[model samples]
Each structure stands twice: as structure tokens, then as C-alpha cells.
Target: MNRKKSLQIFIQSPDLHQIRHESVTGDQTLADLKRSLFPESNHRSSFYFTLHGKPLPDDTPLSIPQIAPLSTLVLQSRLRGGGGDGGATGAESRDCYLKMYSEKKPDKVDPNEQRLSKWQNCALSNEPLREPCVIDKLGNIFNKEALVEALLGKKLPKEFGYIKGLKDMITIRLSSVPRAEDGAKFQCPISGLELNGKYRFFALRNCGHVLSAKALKEVRSSSCLVCHEDYGEEDKVVINGNEDEVAALRERMEMEKTRVREGKKNKKVKGESLEGSRLSGTKHVMAAVEKASAKVEVNGKVSNGGGAAKRFKAIDVAPAHATKEVYASIFTSSRKSDFKETYSCRSLPLGRN
Candidate 1:
């Protein structure tokens, strides 16, 4: 018996449209379903399908050899005629509002303002405020606590406030942070970046706001005066260490390295003949301790970044083996069998017929 390949596809869209269709044959194209999904529209090439919520070409081949079973299919249509071959320049013809303005004013007073005017009424009243700050060069010290506290009062989420500069005003400086005795995790308030150690700094992205650790301490609140959000020490997610703990760890590592280097130079001279001595012993001990402790530290990290979604649970079978029998067995059997049992047996005497 020849196996028939099939697929189960799920369709999703930004306009809140969702559909699920079982592909009975591998030869089926998305264009076939587009008709059922859209009856009145002859412009089949205009709308695009989003598989798993990501835009994909409609003519893309779904199945090979047209023989497979146990597949999942999702059919999604573009919202009210959006994606098309005309591209951005031709988009104006589709929107009546854009066409009206384009005809009314072939030229505008301010090009920037003209674009913004077209997008009127799209602004959100509850939009968040942003601040600017810059990082200094290395070896610079800043009061992170005070800076975060002041920024928190501005009603902006801690993640939005980041380092920025004017004419190279934004300088980044590295400083040590206190660590918890056991271990702890920290997240940068400005960038929402997570780090294992108590202290670390890096350049910020996608933000025009900038402030340094030192200047942030002097400020009482975020520059956005209307925002009155306040942050407390307790609001921070504390780990095993404070800034001091991190400082000590850094110092220890530094001292060990310095001693080892000195010992190596001394041994190279005619005065010291010993290769594996006190310095080597100390280095070995410290390395072992650091490794053991790090192994046990909490691995905290953000799961979602860059708007990527979690991976879908997938079967272990190969794409070619996913045929129609396999697809139906996975989903449709339960629904079909349930319906047959109830409907085929009759509707148990309706009250009024």
C-alpha cells in the first residue's frame, strides 16, 4: 500500500484571525484553501499566509511526493488585503486616506511633519517615557543605587532607561559590585541585561537616554518630571552577594594572578630554582574553590529576548514520514469518532421535533 503524505497547518494573523486545516494530500497548495477562506476576492496574490505566525510565501511547497500522514496544518490569511506585489510605493493606492492626502498635497511644508500627520491618532496616551545617559571610561565609579532609585521615580520601566551621550559624552566605565556570600544574580536596570556577577557594565542600545552612575546618584528622580514612580532597595531581586561580595571576589582573583606572575619571574632568575612552590599551591587552591562555587551558583536568565517565541513541541519523525494517516491519527480521529457515536445513533427524541 502506498502511503499518502499530509500536513496539519495552523494560521495566525495580527488581525486576530486563526484557522486550522488538515491537508488531505501532499499536492495541495495554500492557493486552494485561499478560495474557501476568501470567496469574494479575485486578487489571490495580494494576501500572504503566516505559518506559525511568521509570514511565508503562498506558493511555497508544503509536501513532497504528496504522500504523508499525521500532519498538522494551519491556514492564515492576510487581514483585509495587506501584503501584495505592489510594494511600499504602491501601497497608497490601497488606502483611500493615503490617496486623498497624496492628491490634496503633492508637496508638503515639512516632509518629516507630513509623514507624522499621516499617522495621526496612532499615538498612545499611556506610552512610556525615555531618559538619556552615558557610560564613562574604565576605572570610573558611579552610585548605581541612587541612580536606579531616581530613575524608578520617573514611571519608566527600569529596562527602558539606558546610557546615551552627546558628542561622545556617553562613556562606559567598569566597576566592581558587592557579591552575596553564597551567590547571587543581577539584572541591569537600564538595559534589563542579566549578569552572573554583581558588577559589570556595557554599552546600551535602542535608547537615546543616557546617564552615568555618579550623576544618577545626585539626581532625586528621573528627568521625566511627570513620572513619579519610586524604587525601593527591597524592589531589587537580591542574590547571595552585595556589591562588596563581588569586589572581594575580584580582588582575590587579581591578587592570585599578581602573585603567580611575580613568582614566575622570580623563578626565571638564577636566585630561585623551585618550579612548584607556595605560589603554585595557592593558585591551585583558589582555582578549585572558585570552580566549585560557580558550579553551584543560580543560572538565572531571561527566556524571551528579541521578541522570539518559545520553540514548538515537535514529533521525532522525519518530515517525509509525516503522511495523511499520521496527521489524521494525531488530531481528527477523536473529533470524528465522537461525532459518529452521537449523531449516527440519533438525537434521542427531541422535545418538540
Candidate 2:
């Protein structure tokens, strides 16, 4: 039986700036080993591993004769513009001169370039070159796919519950450019790995700032990074929102409208009730006034001093025959001709003759 063996390898870049130690089995391929060490370098076509200044074929197994345990490997990108003898062509040498000249030219570089570079990174995670990007109103860009996942209840690094809806988000389109003859690509402001749709992205509804969904999960507050707008769970919306999400947003809006309408209706009802109470109070006041006026007319005259008291005493002492005679004398005509005319008219009225 062949025993499985593991070897620890020290991997470094050509500039020796980044070094990582990884343990690999004898059966593992060099490509797999490189992927484990530097995930971002996988897209390069001409990158290779070197042991003691010698290139190793990608298919060479770790158990090869030239490689041993604890071996040191350097990963390097191939130089472009080589001649038949592997020497630099005249045109290539001139190109190098031109590149050197451009680097030394201070006028070509902008002073605010560093600040601008920071803007290209994900504001939440500070990771550069996140794709499927969305910008908020304030021009901050974030990864949209990660944000959608977060909205769907996936765990995220930053808490971006502040975005209210997807209507406030817009997706950003990135253009790619070739970097070298090895087909290496360069994208401004983003130096991270290619967006493989594995990670999710999000944007702030108010500010349009974009970030990774993972980074948004780490947010501790509801404030936007760029615009500083306060947001809630409803404020963090999905970018390029699907129909169901849009419908849900519309439904939420409708619910809010209904609540507002109900509030107004309740206010109107309360106002009308108050008005009714006021009108009822006014009616009661008017009725009391009328009652007081009638009482004054009937009883106030009697209650006043001696004249009214004297009159009342006379009426009480007077006989009923005298009272009737006084009323008849005042109402009946005194003239004889007038009495005769009234009697004749009454006598003829009974038979329509």
C-alpha cells in the first residue's frame, strides 16, 4: 500500500512582498497548490511556480524527484515582448524606456489619486474591484449580489437594514482592459479577485454607496457610510430587484398609504365629533336663553313692585260676572248702527240665502 505523505511548501511572489506557507499532499497538482496560496492569481495564464530558480511543470506531482518536503517556491508572471533568444526585442526595450519615462513624469500623476483610489473600493469592506456593483445617490458603490442574499435572510458581515427599497439603487457597469501580453487584466480602483457571482453585493438606498453583503452584515448602526443618512431594515433594498421584491415594496408603500389615510379619517371624525359637541352646547345655550326670556315676560312683570301686586289683588277679589262684563264692554261696539249691522250679518250667514 502507498502511504499518503504531506509536504509544507513556502510560497512567495516574484517581488517577495507576499509569502504564505501551505501544506499539500504528494498527489496534489501545482495548480491546486497555487490556488490555495494565492486565489487572486488563478486568472493569469502565464504564471508559473519556480523551485531554486527552475520552472516546474504544472502537472508535476509533489512527490517528484526534484521537490522535497519544506521546499521553497516562487510564483512569477512571464515577461512580455521576448525575442527568439529569450532576449528583449529592440521594440520591447524602447517600450520599457517609455514606461520608465512615464513613471518619472510627475505631471502625469494626480495629487488626489490616492483618495480617488479609496473611493473605488467597497466602502463597507474596503475590498477593491467588487462586481455587480450598485451606487447610492451619494455615489458610493457596493456589490449587489451579496446585498440581495442579505435581504433574503442570508448572514452578512455588515448590517445594512437601513435601505428602504430597491427603487433607490442602480447597477454600475465596469469595463475591462488588458494589462500585459500574458492576457492579465486590469481594472481601475479594484485590485481584488474577479467577481465570480459567489459573493453578494448591496447598496445604500439614500446615498447610493455600494458594499459587499458580507461587509454590510457587520454594520452596527443604521447610518449610511457616504451620505450619513439614517436607514432601517426597510431602507436596505435589493439592487436589480426581482418582481416579487418589487411587488413587496409596492405593497409596503400601499400599506403606509392606508395607514396615513386611516389617520386622516380618524382626525376628521374627531373634529366632526368636537364640532357636534360645540353645536349641541350652542343649542343648549340658546334654549336656556329662550326659557329665561319667556320666564321674564310672564313672571318678571308680576314680581316687580306694587303696581303688579295691586292688579293681581283686584283680579282675585273681583267677581266672575264683573270680569265678563268688563271684557264684553271693551270688545263690543258701542254704536247702535254697528251692533245692528253685525247682528244682521250673523243672521244671514247660516243659510247662504
Candidate 3:
């Protein structure tokens, strides 16, 4: 067995229940850790690790790597790669030059000349010019896919992977389709590809795609993905009549979902509702038995707490030949709503309702 060292495995899932132990051995590789964390579940590959805020690829080489020690590992799925290798279209080249020269040029450099210098570097990349990994105004990493999606309002990939990171927030791919101006076509903000409703959403591990509505339904009643609170309902307000109608339908479905959730909740409320019902029927069989045996109350008699004392009753059971019949009688009537008052009196044999 590996030395018993304490290691903290931080999963990206916002669900507290989802995070768990790896195996009995506990000491595991980055790869083994990922696998053990989700044995039967899908989506195991897309996870990458970061130690102390520096992103590390899953395949990172570790020599005498620290294992089984709590060093703070966070699961992430951010895109991998750096910026610019020449090869830029005229528009991109101009933008890059202007951005570099006007905003970032050193004090000694002329902005126009700096723009020209920056443009030359982009012209060298042979690959059909890709977007430079620029930082957005918000300081967020700007890749081609995200920029495209932002420029066009819509999702990038109809089918894309998502993961919940350490802070209890979800991270989704930047490849969704953007809402096009024409209202008919959806283009990817990143790849600039056309998107359709048929696309599916998948796990970060590329498990598969799911429908947006279906996904929303599944997650609607859980803790808030952003705030991680008891509030799980969609908070957005409908802005138009058509939207209001759709919202009403969604609300109806949500009410049904809430009902089903409530049913499960009731099932787990207490044993009194279930076992107590059965015990009431069992009293019938015991009634006759008590009649045959002498009643004994050592100290105090059983009472219904109503200031009055009631005598205990018992059931009479026949010999082996009739035992099956007795059992059938008890089982069948056990589930009846009025089993206690109706068939409970031996003198009265009330049949099915």
C-alpha cells in the first residue's frame, strides 16, 4: 500500500455530492485520479489540472512528482495553446497592427510604425490565419471562438462540452453558434461554422451532445449554478407576448416537475406514513390471538393519550392448513384506506371497495 498521505482532489463539479474519494488505495496518478473520481460516469478526459494557479496539461511530465500530498489541485477545461504564428487576413492583420501599435507600443516607438511592425509578424503564419489569443477588455482570454460568439449574439456550438470547476461554476466550450443578423442562420463565434437546433451538448470529455431544453429541465431545480443557493428556478423575465406564452408552458412543466420532486420528498419524510399503515392492519391478526391468551399489563396499560384507558385486543390464528388464507386476508386488506375501522372488527368482514 502507498504511504498514507493526505491528498485533496478538487473536482470541477458544482454538485457537492459528486465530489468523492478515488479508491481504497487513495494514492493515485493525475490520470488515475480522474478515472476513480467518476468510475461509472461519462466524461473523464477533458479535465486538466492546475497547481497554484498555473495551468498544467494532463500529460504534464512529472519527475519524482509529488503524490498523495495536499497541494491544491483544481480541475479545469480551458483551451490549450498560445497566440499568433504569422498568416493573417487583411482585416485581422490591420486590427492586430492597430491594437499592438496604438495601445501597446513602447514610449520610444511611433504608433504607425509599430502597427506596421506588428502586421509583418502576422503575415508569416502559413495556417489559414487564426485569431490571435488576445486578452479581452474584461481581461478574459479571448480566443477566436469566443470573439466570434460575442461579435454575434448566440451560442457557439450547438453540441459542446461543459464542466463545473472548483468555484462551483460551470465552464462551457467557446464554440457555440452565434445569433445571426438574418435570424435564420447561426454561426459559431469561434470556428465561424453554421449552427442548427439539432446539435447536441456533451460533457467536457466529449461524451455527447444534449438538447438545450432537456439540459435546462434537468438542472432547473438544483442549486443555482452561479450562486450555489437553494434558488434554482430560472429568474429571467419574459419580454414579449410570444415569449410570455412559451414561458407559461415552461412554468407548467416546471410545476409538474416540482410535483414529482415533492413525491420523492414525501416518500423519504418518515417511516410513520408507510410502516404505520401496515401496522394498523397487523393489529387485526393480533386481535384473535389476544383473545386466546390472558391479557397482562405489568404496570400501566397502553393508552391513546386521551385521558381514557383502552383494553388491548388480539387476533386468533388457525392451524397450518388455514395459515395461507390468514396471510392473504391480512396482506390484501393491509393497503386499504379504512382497513383499521372497516374489517378490523372480527364480527364484521368487509370485502373489497
Candidate 4:
């Protein structure tokens, strides 16, 4: 056999703190690279290789242009389940082999164009479906957490206008799954870790997409990742959620309700105050008109000093209809103050009578 040409490479752990140098044949596959780097460990399947923040395909040859001499590569381990003995538990070991072996990027599929079934991987995160998973009215299945975060204001490339709030969505329980055994190895699309109580999961009330609590905490916006649905404060619900989180969600919902109720109450009070002021202003105007009318009647009797004046006053003031007409004329007049000024000047001349 001909001598194999070897390439020098630098390898580092996921944290980038542990670095090592190794020599390997140009034709060696990624699996072979992992074995060489982690010779003492039997759980090599838990680790994956990455180059420049992107995962490397296991089938990719070391001689590829991207793998230059002394090039640095990241060897990351999937976040494992906790153990009772302070080491990886038996479940962790069993789930290690289930880790994604390929280097394909998550969210490679377009959610708008593709219609994924409930049993298939998520179109956005590429993780297996789990409890609290929901199929939207459009027949698309997604994790609740992803939907909640998307609704909570996380920016997404696509637009989902059909979803409005959690009340419109339906929740899926563990018993409803057609094949419960198939989802035992479900992992988070973002963290690539097995879903468990420690990591926790959340679902969106609107789209019913599930996501890990850790992933939701990192969300800065209200848009869902899979469907791009925007979620409001009331649209998030815990899927097999922690007690602390559940209580907090309830408290937040109550607070929001109280705030909305108080806002409406304050608005009603302001409206009533405005109506009361209008009524008081109308009464003031009526009082001013009545005072002016009484003065007009007294002037007519005093200035004339005859039975004819008394008769004219009785015709003008005794009938309510005639008095109302006089009031209307004074108020509708272009110069409202002119009537008051005219009455004041006439009253001074009437003093002699």
C-alpha cells in the first residue's frame, strides 16, 4: 500500500478553551477525525465537528479546501441529560446516538412553501415534535415555544397574519400523540439537547409551536420562528412547564387584565366629567337668559306707567311660548353681549320712572 499523506489540524472543544494539535490522513472522514481526537472516550457519537461556526459533514474528506493545514475546528458535545451519580445517566448514553450526525443547517426548509406534518421535524428548527405541539388551522405543525417566542416579538423572515392570539390555537397533550415512543429522543432545535424537566419547554397559545424555556428566555421579539406569527403577552403557555414558570405566567396574566380594566374605568370617568361640565354650562346660560328677561319685563312696566304697558307685558311674559322665543333670539344673535349691553343702558334710563 502507498504511504498516506497526513494533514496537521488544530482542534478545540466547544468552549474554545481546550486546544490540541493532531495529524491525520487527507482521506479520513469526520468520524475518523473524532476517534483520533477523543481516543479515550467511548461516547464519540455525542460530539460533532464545526468549521467557522458551521457544522462539517461527516462524509466530507479532510483534503477539502475548507480544511487547510493547521486549520482550527470545534468539537462540540450535545448537552446531555443529568445523572444521579454526578456523571452522564443511562438515558443520556442511550440518547447520545440519537444526536444529529449530519451538518445540515436548521431552518433550511421554507415554512411558507412547505407543509410539514405533525410527526415530521420542525420546518424552522429541525427538531422532533414533542408535547404541546400543535397544528395550526392551516394544518402546519410546530413546537409551542417556537411559536410563542415568534409571537413574543422575535423577528422572522416570513409573515404569519392568520394567527392572532393563544385563544385561537389548540393544545396537544402527550396522550394525543399517535406514536409516543418515536418522540422519546426529541431535542431542542436551538440547543440540540434532549428535552427534559431541567431544560423545560413552552408552547405558543396562538400557533401551538413548542420551544425550550432557555430558548424563549433569549428571545428579544414577539415573532414565532416557524410560522413567523407575532404573539402577545397572553399567548404564551408552558408545555409540561415548571411550577415557578406556571405561577409567574398566571400572575402576569392577572396583572395585564387588571391594567386593561383600570384603563377602561379611567376613560369612563373622564367621559362623565366632560358630560357634567357641559350640563353645568347649559344651566349657566339659561340662568343668564332668565335674569335678562325679568329685567326687560320690569323696564316695560316702569318706563310706560300705564295700563297699556301692563297689558303689553302680560302678552309678552305670561305666555311661556313667547318668553322662550325671546330667549332663543338672544342666544342665537350674532352679538350675544350686545343684548346685555343694550339692556344695561335702558335700565339706567328707567330709574327716572
Candidate 5:
């Protein structure tokens, strides 16, 4: 009976400047919980209650979906104009719906949803982020093993062809936030904001400083907010960016690596010179070339009457599975041919025609 109620939620103040965590069990009523949480204002009726822009009645019990654990409850005064959480009356104008009923806040983002996308899941495989993770030039994180598997299977999407190989990306070290029952796994080191989708975050390329994007705008410095080290615009990679940002990042990566590709192309040897050919590579093909040249040499000396003709030894080119005799039989002169060898008439004078 003494244990704390596990169904927890966050309560945002009127100014949106502070958030307080509150928990309730199934047995507790909403009025009792709210009254206990906000005791200072007894006459104000504590304004109205809201859960994600939708109005909630004072008596709404803790066991319903609206009161689910980890959901946020915002407390706003009538003056702020986001007051009505319950649906307006039939006579109420469209402006009432736009101001109170609309869930579309100008820059509203679900922290839980963003957390899953940015920290728990990967971009390449669309799977859970596991050990051996990697980050790209755009600060997008992925499971390294998944990327390797996709690369080997040739299953990578055509749009991601910018990843020429492992060289295009680097292994990134993530500073994991300690786990809590309702805590985010990653966050901005400087702002202390959770890396949930509610706020934009970026990682520094040189030093791996992951922080909120607001820090960059406010500081407006060319150095990291956390490390205070010098960095260029190219070094700051936005996390979980939109399509245009991703496309720009991919282009920048390819453009920067162009020099590496050109250098490799320039370093390759064009062709070996005649004098250089004999000095390099295997001798397996060399034996075949030598045998052919020996045939020409033998015929030339005999015509010139230089001396006894030199004998050319046939090189063994048979596969390991073949015997020398069987292999040689394939090319021996014993094979029958349709044409006969012709000799000069003067040279054959002593022989019968």
C-alpha cells in the first residue's frame, strides 16, 4: 500500500518554462491528484487541463488512455489562449477550435516518437540500434553490422549509392545516457535536453559533441558548444534531418571525397615497358612465350647454316589433374592432317618425285 503509483506523467507550467513529474495509480481520482499537485491556487480553479492540446475534464480518472504513464499534462491560464482542452460549444467560432482544439502547435514534436527515431532505431536497416553503430556525414546513426550485411547482399537502396564503401562512413562513439524508467537514451550534453524529437540536435564531426541545435544558433560560434573546440560548418552534422538536409549532406560527402578518387586513379601504373616486363609478375605465362620464340629461332639458324639446330623443350602446361603424356597428345604432330608438307623441287632432286 505504501509503494508509489507507477503511472507517471509530466506537468508543464503556464509559461512552458518548467516541467514537473507526477505519478498516479488507478485508485486515485484526477481531481484529488491535481488538487494535491497544485495547492497554492485554491480560487483560480487551476485553469483548465490539457493532454496534447485536447481538453480533459477534472474528473477524468487515472486509468484511461489520456492519463497513460509518461504522457504530458499542460497547465495553461486563460490569458495564454491555449486554454480550452475540452471541445468548445456548438456556437463557438472556428477561432476557438484553431486556438484550443487544434493539436497542431507551430513546432510541436513528440519527444517519445523522436527519441525512438533518433536513438533507439537505425536509418539504413530500419531496425533497432545495436552495438557497433556508425554515423554518417549527416550525423545519422545506424547499426554498423546491418549496413555491412546490406552492402554484402547488394540490398542497399539506389538512393544511398553515395556510400561507395566502408571508406565513406566512419565508426562513431555514442555517449549513452544512463537509462531511467522514463528517460531518454541520448541527449544534448550542453542543454541537458533529451534527444527526443521535440528539439533538434547535432553532432560535431571532429570531436563527437552531440548537443541541441539551439545552442548553435544562440552561440553563433564556429566552435563546439560542449568542447569549445574550433569547428567548421561542414563539421556540424544534423541528426534526424529532413530529406533536403540529407540530400545536401550526401552531396557534400561525395564532393569532398572526389580528390581521394582522383589520387587513386593517378597512382595506377598505365602499362609496363618492354624492359620492365621481364622483371615483374609470375613466370607461368612467361614459359609459354619462351616456347613460341624458340620455334622461330630454330628455323632461322637452319636456313643460315649456322650450326646444329638447337632443340626446344616443350613446357608442361597441363593442369594438376592431367598427366603430361595425355596433355601432350592433344598438340603432338602425330595427329592426322588433310594437307601434306611441300618441299622445294631443287632441294628434292635426289629423291623420287
Candidate 6:
């Protein structure tokens, strides 16, 4: 034990999530730390120390930059996996020794601790959160690739039906916690508070910058504090919100989609109406011109001093706004032909009679 430099150790063997504190010198080795956690055990070499989910070399000195003071270090056993064991213990000894030990089965990993370990994993696939991550209105994060695969495979759950397409969600850029020592995973850039569900956090849709709600309210600015990007009230989304908070967000999402659909329908109706009016106007102008050009005879008198009075037939064009079924019938063989298909030499073809 040394008083000069101190570090925090989190061993997860007997009791999970239980942090054990032990002071060590800069020149001390990892083996020494393992012995402190299990002093009575002669199987000290059977365990190892891990930092940031990576196992350190047995001879690694604690003076390195990565081993920051008060930073957490996890203790893991060297044994890997097990299966095919009997009910109580594997007395055959042909099976792995881990199964043969009745009293010393591998400690069960706490469910909450498992979730904390997978903090950066995708909510849908439970895989590592990769680039192109998407956040729904309820603030649940998911991998875009995993979502696409699920959609294509037709295996998406009914509860996730709210995510109709990419339009329902927004992409967010998360900022990792800078301090490696703390148990927090993500952090608020402005307040520098841990974003481990303890405090309220919001990610701006305009800039994807995540900041604590306290910071945004204190400054009272319309732009993101981190990137200074301008944003509207609709762009702000709560991260990992409570039940009531998420319900409000879901209602807002539905309203926005409804407004957009209404706008599109209105545009289509306006366009169709304009085209219909133009076609009808053209037909009326044609009828007026036919009357103006035609001459008529009255009481054996020449009209408009013309050499001969004349009559003109009205144009026989079909209406432009016919339905598909009527339009198709216009080209059938039963319809009257305006001009006959005269044969050149009174024969249909060489093979015809």
C-alpha cells in the first residue's frame, strides 16, 4: 500500500457493481492489485486487470497515462466459457473443471451491470453503436444498418411501427465522456455532467449537439451552445425521456406528419383544377371562332357582302378528361373510322386471299 498516489478499483467477482478502493504506488504492478482484491486465494495468476474493457499486461506499471488516478479498473477471471455440464457438478472430469466445481460456479453477471457495460450498443441489435446512428422521438438510439436489415427482412416488431421510415427519426452525434475514470459513458458538452440518465439532456436536430437542459435554459439562446447552429423549438428532442415526456413527443411527431400529408394533397388538387379549366377554355374559344368565320343567307340577301353564304361543321374532338376505361374504348375496332384503310393492290398481304 502507498499513500502518494491513489486509484479506485471495481472488482466484479463475488459482488457485482461493488467498487473496492485500494491505494497503490506509481511503480506498482497489476499483479499486486489483483492480490489486494483476493488476498486469501492462491489463484492470483488466474485473474487479470482490465481498463476500458481491455486487459492490461501483467507487468504493466500503473504510472502510465492511461491509468489515470481514481480511474476504474475491472477484475476479470482468465477462464472463458462453459457448457455440457451435469446438473450439480461434472464428476466425470472429462468435462471442463469449471463444471466439476459444485460450490464455485461462475458468478452471475448482474443484469443492470450488463446494460451499463453495453451502454454504447444499439437498442435494436444490441451490437456496438456504429456511425450513422439514428434517434427516435422518444430518444432511443439505434444503428441505421440494423434497422434497415430488420425492415428488409420483415422481422421488425409491431411496437417499432412508429418508425415508418427515415423521416420519423433524426440522426444524432453523441459526445463521449472525456474523463476515463468516471463510470459515466456519455456527457453533456456544456455542463460537463454525466448523461447516465441522472439528468435531463436534449439533442438539437439542427446541429445534433447534445447539451444539458439546465445549460440551455440558463443561457436562453436559440442556437446550439456547442456548435452555435441556429435551431427552432421543434428541433429540440429529449434524450431518454420519461413516460409522459415521450408521450408528448409522440403526439408531436404524428401532428407534423399529418400536416405534411395535407399540404401535398392540396397541391395535387390545385394542379388538376388548373389543367381542367385550361382545356375547357380552349374548347369554348374554338366554338366562338367557328361562328365568327361562318356566313349565313337571309331574305335572299348576301350577308357581310360575301360572294356566297357558307356553313361550317363543328369540330368532333373528344373531351380531354375521360376516364381510363373510356379512353381505351376509343381505339377499339367497333368504333367508326374517320378514314377507311384502303388497300394498295386490293390485297391485305402476300399470304392473304
Local accuracy by lDDT, each model: 0.38, 0.54, 0.38, 0.58, 0.64, 0.68
Identify the superior model by lDDT, candidate 3 or candidate 6: 6
lDDT per residue as tens, model 1, 1-353: 11234343433333544333333445556666676667888877767654323344666555633312322233333445545776565333434543354368532233333222222111111111112223222111123332344444554333333322232123222222246232222334443333332233323222312223323344545341123344442111212234674455446546755898898887687344454476788898987765544432122333442233443222322255576456546755322442323545643334533
What value does the lDDT take at residue 58 in candidate 3?
56
**Candidate 3, residue 326: how far the Cα is off, in Å:** 47
The worst-scoring run of ten residues by lDDT in candidate 3 lies at: 120-129
- Output the better candidate (5/6) by lDDT: 6
Instruction: Give the alpha carbon lDDT tens digit for every residue of 162-223 in model 3.
Output: 21112211222333334435222323332343323232222121211112333434555343
Candidate 4's clash total is 26
Candidate number of the best TM-score: 6
RMSD of each: 40.3, 23.1, 27.0, 21.1, 14.4, 16.1
lDDT of 2 by residue, 57-155 (tens): 888777785775545676766665556896656644544554464358521222233233334445443345467776543334566764565556644
List ranges where model 5 is wrong by over 4 Å: 1-115, 219-229, 264-353
- In model 6, which regions exceed 4 Å deviation? 1-119, 179-182, 295-353
Query: Which is better, 2 or 3, measured by TM-score?
Result: 2
lDDT of 6 by residue, 2-69 (tens): 33454433354423555555557777788777776678999888777666556688889877878765
Candidate 1 off by > 4 Å:
1-3, 16-18, 52-54, 64-353
Candidate 4 accuracy as lDDT: 0.58
How many clashes show up in model 5? Answer: 2
Query: For candidate 3, what is the lDDT?
Result: 0.38
Where is model 2 more than 4 Å wrong at Cα?
A: 1-215, 264-272, 295-353
**Selected candidate, larger TM-score, 2 vs 5:** 5
